[model samples]
Every structure is written in C-alpha cells, then in structure tokens.
Target: MSAPYVLVLYYSRHGATRSMAQQIARGIEQAGIEARVRTVPPVSTQCEATLPAVPNEGDIYCTEADLKDCAGLALGSPTRFGNMASALKHFVDSTSGLWMSGALIGKPASVFSSTSSLHGGQETTLLSMMLPLMHHGMVIAGIPYSETALLNTQTGGTPYGATHVAGSDSNRPLDEHETTLCQAQGRHLGQLALKLQD
Candidate 1:
C-alpha cells in the first residue's frame, strides 16, 4: 500500500482560504501523514469555455485520482452567500463517478472556510461542503470542543469545522484561534484516518 495522505483541497479568490489550507496541511503533516495541497480552477460563464489543465499560480489542479486515493480530505473554500464557492462546488459535482462506485466510502473528511465578514456564512459553507462527502459515504470529522481555540476564538472557530474571518478587505490574516483550530481540525482528521486505516 502507498503512504497515507490527506488531500487539502480548496479554492481561494484572495488567498485567505488558501492560507488556511496550508495551515491545515501543516497540521496534517505534523500528525505523521503526508499532505497533498490542490486547487480547482475558476469557472467561466462563457458557454463551453474551460480553464487550463493546470492553474497558473498557487497549487496544482486536483485530479479525480487524488480524491480517489486520499486516505483523508480537508476541503476548503471562501464563502459564497453561505455556501462553498462555485469553482470548488463545480469540481466536486463532477465526482459522481466516485460516488457511484463508493470509492470514497470509509475515508475521513473535514471542511474549512473563509469569509469577508464575521457572520458571512462560514459555518454554513463548511456544512455545505460536507453534504456531498456524506453522500459519498465518507465519515465526517470536525473540531472537537477539546481544542481550546474553539472556546477562545472571537473571530472564527466552530465545531462544524475550522474557519477564518478575512474581514471586509479580505486582508486580515488568521488570528491565533483560527490558526489553532485549523491545525487541530487537520490533526483530528489525520488521526481518524490512521485509526480507520488500521
């Protein structure tokens, strides 16, 4: 068998969500598993138009094979009216083949998000991301209360998943609580993946 890896998949317009994905990946690696960071291309409205096979910047584009082979997943996206971004959603919606085959069943999964405002649907976006994974039969994981950050965070940290308040300008870096929760969520999913592997 190949080494276990947690796929950190995300889409970010201004880089906040992408930063969170990096932190989560750091935590996943800290838990003694590999972290494969990937991103989906933005969708265009022009009929039949498509993005290039590889993104021009940041992480490489995620492949169906990456999703199929991952032992765990950390999905992230910027909130779009209390939902995941259209680009990430578009990519995930294309995974029905895996869902039909039950290829992702029993894998561990978690979610994260970043929003422009404090109440801009962070939790809802996280939950929205989880719905399809649940349909794929993946076990959902979230940040537990044991992570002190959940209690201390005034910006963003929820039991549903890790989140960040990027503020109206989308320039605010993750606060301490956001960082800790991201790491904790990543570690939580990684540990669960290990246990599930055994």
Candidate 2:
C-alpha cells in the first residue's frame, strides 16, 4: 500500500492561489509526506455543458478519492467578495458521500486564500473554506502565532490561515512573508496529520 499524503487542493483564476498551493505542497513534502496537488475546473454558465475530465494544462481536477484518502487537506481559492470562489465550493459541496461515510473524519485540514487587495477578505475567505471541511468532521488547523511571519507580514499572513495580497490588478507576486506563511501553514497541518493518525 502507498504511504499517506496531504492533498493540496485549490482553484486559481489568475494564478496567485496556485503559487500558494505549490509552496504549501513543498512544506508538506518537508514533513516527509507526499503532497498531492489538484485543482478544480471553473463553473460554466450553462449547466448542460461541463469541463472536460482532464485539464488542458496545470494540475488536473480533484477527485473524491483524492479527498477521501488524504491524511490531511490544504484547501485554497481566490477570494470572491469575502468568500471562496464558487468553483472550489461547488466541488467541495459534492462530497456529501464522503461526509456521510465519515471518510474525512479526524483528518486535519487547513485553508488558504488570495485576494486582489490588502483588505479583500483574506480572513473571511479562509473562514468560508473551512465551513465544508468542518462539516466533514475534519479537525481544523491554522497558522499559529509561533509563526512569526504572522506578526511581521506586511503583505499577507493571518491566524485564520495563510493568505496572499495579490493587489488590485491580481498581478502582484507573493511576497516573502506570504510565502513563509504558506509553508508554515502546510507544515503545521502536515504535522497535525502525522500526529493524529495514531
């Protein structure tokens, strides 16, 4: 059988969230666990049509098995009016089967988000992402004050989760503090996953 892993699942529109996912995955790997990265497709205006099973490039779509089997989970999305984007939420909402089966119960989970402005609901979006995981009976994890970047970050770092201020144009790269927080959140969640397994 394969060793356990953390699933880094996210939805990115302009790519900042995707960058954060990569850094979080790096931290999970640092904890000596596999980081399985996955992304969800965008929502179409028409319900009759759907995205292809495989993405054209970048990470492929996340599957229920991916979520069910993960030792831990790191969920990310771009902020949309102080909430997670609809695409990520939609995918998560489809996990009722896992929730009913208690497949995710007891696993540690964390959330992260990127916003277009400094005050663009980074914390709220992170909180919004946590709601579904909570429903799945997963243990919630957050970046602790021990991560000094939470105190020093001028760009993005929060106790709710790791965050990135992507600027109004959605073009700003993640600053050093944002990157540090991402890794820190991932490491904390990964450690929790390892410790909780027993």
Candidate 3:
C-alpha cells in the first residue's frame, strides 16, 4: 500500500479557490502527512465539448482512485448560487461506488469555498460540499471557534469552513485571515486523520 495522504481536491474558475487549496495542502504537509492536490475540469453546458485528458496547465485532474484511497480530504469550490460549482458536484456525484463500499467512512473531510461577493453564500456552499462526504460516512471537520482567525477575519473565515471573497471581478486575493483559516482547517483535518487511523 502507498503511504497515506490527504487529497486536496477542488474546482477553480478564477484561481482564488485554487490558492486556498494550496495553502491547505501546505498545512497538511506541516502536519507531516502528504497532500495530493487535484482539480476537476470545467463542465460545459454543451455535451459535445469535452476537456482533454490532461489540463493544459495548473493542477492535474482528480481520479476515482485518488478519492478512494485518501487518508483525509479537503474539498473546495467556487460558490454558485449558494452551492458548489457544477464541475465539483459532478465529480462528487460520480463517487457512488465509493459511497456504496463505504470507502470514505470514518475519514476526515473539510470544505472551503470562494465567492465573488462577501455574502455570496459561502457558508451555504460549504454546507453543500459537506453533504456528499456525509453520505459517504466521512467525518466532517470545520474551522473551530478556537482559531482566532475565525473570530477576527474581516474578509472570509467561518466555522463551516475556510472561505475567500474574490470581489466582483474575482480578482481579489485571499487575505491573511482567510489563508490562516484554510491552513488551520487542513492541519486539524490531518491530525484527526492520523488519530483516527490509530
């Protein structure tokens, strides 16, 4: 068997969510566990248009095996109408086999989101992401109140999960508080994963 790792899987449209994923991965590594970063390809409304097997740039695509074998998971996505983007949701929906087998049962999982506006349903989106993991029987982890960033964050940090406000143009970067919360969530999940394995 391969060494256990946390899967940092996300779907990024403007890169803010992707940046948060990287920070989460850093925290997982800081916890002395491997972090496997992966992304899903954009979904097109038109069925005929398909993405290449490999993305031209950025993180490689996530595979079923990656999801099945992870020691823990950090799922992220851009908020769309108070929910996760279709691309990430599509990937999650494809994991029924894992769900049926309970492959993720007892594993730790957390969620994060990016939105173009501060009130763009960040918490709801985080909740939406959690539903699938719950169905798979994964233990959900969230940013705890003890994290000072959650108390002081002016931009984006929540008990549900880490978040980033990307501004209207989706050009805003993650603020210090947002970044800190993301890392904290990752580290907490990693620690939980290790302990649960014992």
Candidate 4:
C-alpha cells in the first residue's frame, strides 16, 4: 500500500488560517507521518464558474481523491459568523459520494479555525466542520486537557479543536498557547490514525 498521510485541508482569505494549517502540518510530520496540505477556492456569486485546475499560488486545490486516501484529516477555516466559510463548506458538501461509499469511515479527523476576534465563534466553527466529518463516519479527535496548552490558552485553544485569535486586523500572530494547541491536535490525530492503521 502507499505511504500514510494526514490531509491538512483549509481555506484562508486573510492568511491566518493558512498559518495554522502549516503549524498543524509540522506537528503531523513530527509524529512520523506525511502531511498533505491542500486548499479550496472561493465561490463567486457570478454565473456558474469553476476555478482553474491548479491554483496559481499557495497550496494546491484539494481533490476528492486526497480526502479518500488520507489516513487522517486536519480541517481548518476562517470563522464566518460561528460557522466555517462557504468555500470550505462547498468543498465538504461535494463529498457526499465519499460519505455514501463509506470511504472515510473510522479515520481520525480534527479541526482548527481562525477568527477576527477572541470570541468570533471559534468553537462553533470548529463544531460545524466536525458535523460533516462525523456524518462520514470519521472518528473525531480534539485537544485533551493533557495538552497543557488547553489550560493555559487565554486566546483560542478549546476542547473542540485548535483555534487562533487573529484579531480584527488579522495581524496578531498565534500566541504560544495557540501554537502548542495546534501542534498537540496534529500529533493527537496522527497518532490515532497510525494506531487505527495497525
């Protein structure tokens, strides 16, 4: 069989969520698994149109194949009124085929998010993402209390998933707690995936 990989999928308009994806990928790799980072294009209100096959910059667009083949998943997005952005949601909505086929059943999945404010619905956004993954029969994972960062975070860490307070300017870098929580979530998901594979 091919090597195992954790799919780190996300959508970022202001770069904050993208940065979190990178950190999560780092932790995934640290757990001795490959990290495949991918992103989805934004949806336009204009008449039906599709994005180019390949993105011009940043991570490549995600394919259903990537989702099906991944051993684990780390999904991220920028919060939009306590929910995931439409772009990421659109991508997930297309995965009904995977759900129908039970292709993702039993895989470990985690979530992360970025918000413009400290309480900009980070937890709600994370939970919203988890709902679809759970429907696909994926096992949800989250940062546990053992991850010290969860207890120390004054900004974004939560029992639901990793998160970041990007502030209204979207310029505040992730604080130490946020970084540690992201890494912890990645490591937890990676380790669980490895265990499941065995």
- Model 4, 1-198: lDDT tens digits are 899999999999989999999999999988989999999988887532455767788999999999999999999999999999999999999999999999999999999999999879998999999999999999999888998888888999899999999998998899999999888888888888899995
- lDDT tens readout by residue for model 1, 1-198: 889899999999999999999999999988989999999888787542355767778999999999999999999999999999999999999999999999999999999999999899988898989999999999999999999989999998899999999999999999898999999999898888888985
Model 3, poorest ten-residue lDDT window?
45-54
lDDT (Cα, tens digit) per residue for candidate 2, span 51-103: 67678989989999999889999999999999999999889989999999999
The runs of at least 3 residues in candidate 3 whose Cα sits more than 4 Å from the true structure, single-residue gaps closed, are: 45-50
Ranking by lDDT: 1, 4, 3, 2
How close to the true structure is residue 11 of candidate 3, measured as C-alpha lDDT? 97
Superposed model 2: Cα runs more than 4 Å off: 46-50
* Superposed model 1: Cα runs more than 4 Å off: 46-50
- Residue 73 of model 3 has an lDDT of 95
> Clashes in candidate 1: how many?
0
Superposing all C-alpha atoms, what RMSD in Å does each candidate have to the true structure? 1.4, 1.3, 1.5, 1.3
| C-alpha local distance difference test of each model | 0.93, 0.91, 0.92, 0.92
Clashing pairs in 1: none
Candidate 3 per-residue C-alpha lDDT over 81-130 given as tens digits, one digit per residue, 9 for 90 to 100: 99999999988998999999999999999999999988999999999899
